[model samples]
Target: MKMTEVSFDIETVPSTIRYYLKNATFYDSSCSDNAKTVFVKGADGAFLKISKKGSLEREYRMSNFLSTHKVAPKVFAYESDLENDYLLSEAVSGEDGTSELYIENPNKLASVFGEYLSMLHSLPTEGCPYKNRTAEELNELTNKEASLNILTEINYSAIDDVIIHGDYCLPNIIMDNFSFKGFIDLGYGGIGDRHYDIYWGIWTLNYNLKTDNYKDIFLDAYGRSKIDRDGLTYFTQLIKLCD
Candidate 1:
């Protein structure tokens, strides 16, 4: 996506982050409606995300946790007031997975994507602060006003929990010259079922490439032997309900 240069008054920013805004150009890089993200262009590049108060606490914690594993950006400061929260973090190196250079070659991109996802899932979750996201998500789904009967038919007794990138779509995964760099937007990340990531891996490829051709290539690279078809189907439906 193109980041359009925009005018911003730095005086309105949180005092804790005003030091990073000196003589920096502002770009409107926001992709979500829930928050406003400004890209600070200066000698020391950074991103300033502003949102409702308390909305970013989990993201701040998750980013710090993943940064320790060398897979995410380091947070500079997180300041909150009665009205809003401001998060400042260093900009990660590399273009996101949706870059044209990578999307031009779907096969290679799919393989690299699968390999990196497998690597992420292999990381130990012993110290992870967020746990059992699968159960939490199910609770949310069950509480939804809409009636979803499929939730009753699926048995979640057997689940292979792992550290999952909750939103594993193309825009969230960063790549540097076809090599894995890091992941962004970690608000939903935590200890969850692997199928959550796998389902998104397949969905993103289809959505970005506008075809359903690369699903098997990605599944194969991630090892189909480790995947449970029933689990994948269940999570796919679960996500649809939540959406």
Candidate 2:
């Protein structure tokens, strides 16, 4: 990963499926892009972030705001594509949350992320009008019968009211040896319920960490009741199956 540069490589099955060059350029609808992209290229490298215009605007706001709140890549400029509209930005350096942290020393893992999530949750929820990703909203989003039954069985409001990553999975979080560098993909991040984030953390530590003790260690550190385990588990699945 290169810093203070506009070029970036996209990661995919083939290692690098594509790349973008960003150079303080704004959106342009006349370009050969239907998918809006923010392109920049500097001495280090180049990168392109592809997204719809609305999503690009939202991501730009998030990238700016989140950088101040936590760790996020900086934005040089953004513009609409010639054929489509996609957003782009400079890439930040660091590993995602799906690091060895989840596969090793779960107590340490939970303790580390537990503190971060707690810190985010402890913030005052004022002036933020975003709603939590509740099971209700999830149901409305998807109507597949197989998925609906699974969602209906679980109660999403049991342990609600925390700043959920919205997509609190391993990949969204970035870390380096128990050290949290920052978070990415804040598409769903907002002042929602803490349980949303905690549930994923708890589940990941327990299942991926493959430790029976993780459930207790996480609950103790997270300062929540184990009684909400069922809800957390159900909601975690619901979050995973979300479109």
Candidate 3:
């Protein structure tokens, strides 16, 4: 990781500039030890994210696609060396939902999150080049001993396809004084069930805040028109099994 100068937006000069490494691992949920996030502060006062090689191809692809029509951060540069791949992106400005600012308004937080998720699920997935297939996800759990018992519980009959964030937790979303900003960590993003993300949304809130109060409120705010309660339960159970 050299402190070389880099600029993404301006196209006239086209030269490398150094950036300061901020955080080595922005999130704690990296699926593999080799996969990590490196946050950097650019000379132009922008934030850029760099990730391990071989791990961010999908993220780069999906982020570019989402940035075109949604509130995703802009991609700057994606490169790789011998040991690591790098993805440089403009950071989503503002504090995350996990910050204390939202602590006073958990009800509003849950409702707004529900609406944001609803809008995300409403996006058309046509020509989308990725998918978070159940079978593929299940394979990620095969090595876990607890996953064996839950194997029989896997029901492939239900599917509500949409372009999902894959990991729809609080930290992945950003907000400024309770207003929505944008999304981050699109590594697991693809076409999948809306319930998968919803389950994670509820789980992340409860896990981070240490409360169960907002689950029902969020679900209610999300509306019942397109959600399947049984599907939610099933997907939640599947995630628990993996854990």
Candidate 4:
């Protein structure tokens, strides 16, 4: 994942870390070489984005991944510099949907997230042009064996054939009020089941974490009495292995 130093004259504008880049360890090599993402105000009163190399290729490849959804940040371009990669794009208009509003108002969390996530899953999967994952696909993705009974035990039969936001948790969900802008990190956005989205969304809240009542609130908001809780439990355990 290293890039050969090339003297590509792309005078990168100065940047700042408006917030923590999701993963610190791979912030450069695994995430972005110029991992310090910034929010700069332009003369026109709009925020412009500037990114440096690292995992630009992988990120760029998934640039269009979340385009179908109206909520994602609009990407401007990804071009090769002398010896590195660079990404330019428009900034998201609002704060992350998982902001103070939702956190402080935890009860509003599930209902808003429920309907928003459903909209994401409802996107047409036919011409998605992205990889769709299954239990078997996941198996090939890791050293641990993925289980097929994940759906059955989790009671996930009701929802299928929709896009699964691999990281459907809060951070990735950007919003201003109830207006969800779009999704980010298309790197993992692809076709799958409805439960996958809901499962992770509730698990990672870290607030009502480890509590079934909080998760139930989300389901209640989503208007569902039955879901594959077992499947979510399994995935949560699986994700823990990743940590």
lDDT of 4 by residue, 1-243 (tens): 121322222234323222222221211112244443433334211222244445555555454656645556656556554554555445565556556666777667667777777777667776665555555345554565444444235543333477777777776676777577767655565666566677677776654433555676677766575356665565565455454
User: What TM-score does prediction 1 earn?
Assistant: 0.94
Of candidates 3 and 1, the better by lDDT: 1
Name the better of 2 and 3 by TM-score.
3
How much is the lDDT of residue 17 in candidate 4?
A: 28
> Global lDDT of each model?
0.87, 0.56, 0.70, 0.55
Query: Once all C-alphas are superposed, what RMSD does model 4 give against the true structure?
Result: 8.1
* Ten-residue region with minimum lDDT total, candidate 1: 151-160
Candidate 1 local lDDT, 57-88, one digit each (tens): 88888888888999889999999988888999
Residue 36 in candidate 3, Cα distance off native in Å:
5.4
Give stretches of model 2 more than 4 Å off: 1-47, 52-58, 82-85, 89-93, 100-105, 127-129, 135-161, 210-213, 225-243
TM-score of each: 0.94, 0.61, 0.78, 0.67
Clashing pairs in 3: 4-17, 4-18, 5-16, 5-17, 5-18, 6-17, 53-85
Residue 68 accuracy (lDDT) in model 4 = 44
Q: What is the lDDT of residue 226 in candidate 4?
A: 35
Candidate 3 ranges beyond 4 A from true positions: 1-45, 141-156
Q: Pick the candidate with the highest lDDT.
A: 1
Candidate 3 lDDT over 80-107, as tens digits, reads: 6665566667766676777777767888
Q: Which regions of candidate 1 fall more than 4 Å away from where they truly are?
A: 144-149, 155-160
Model 1, position 77: C-alpha lDDT score: 93
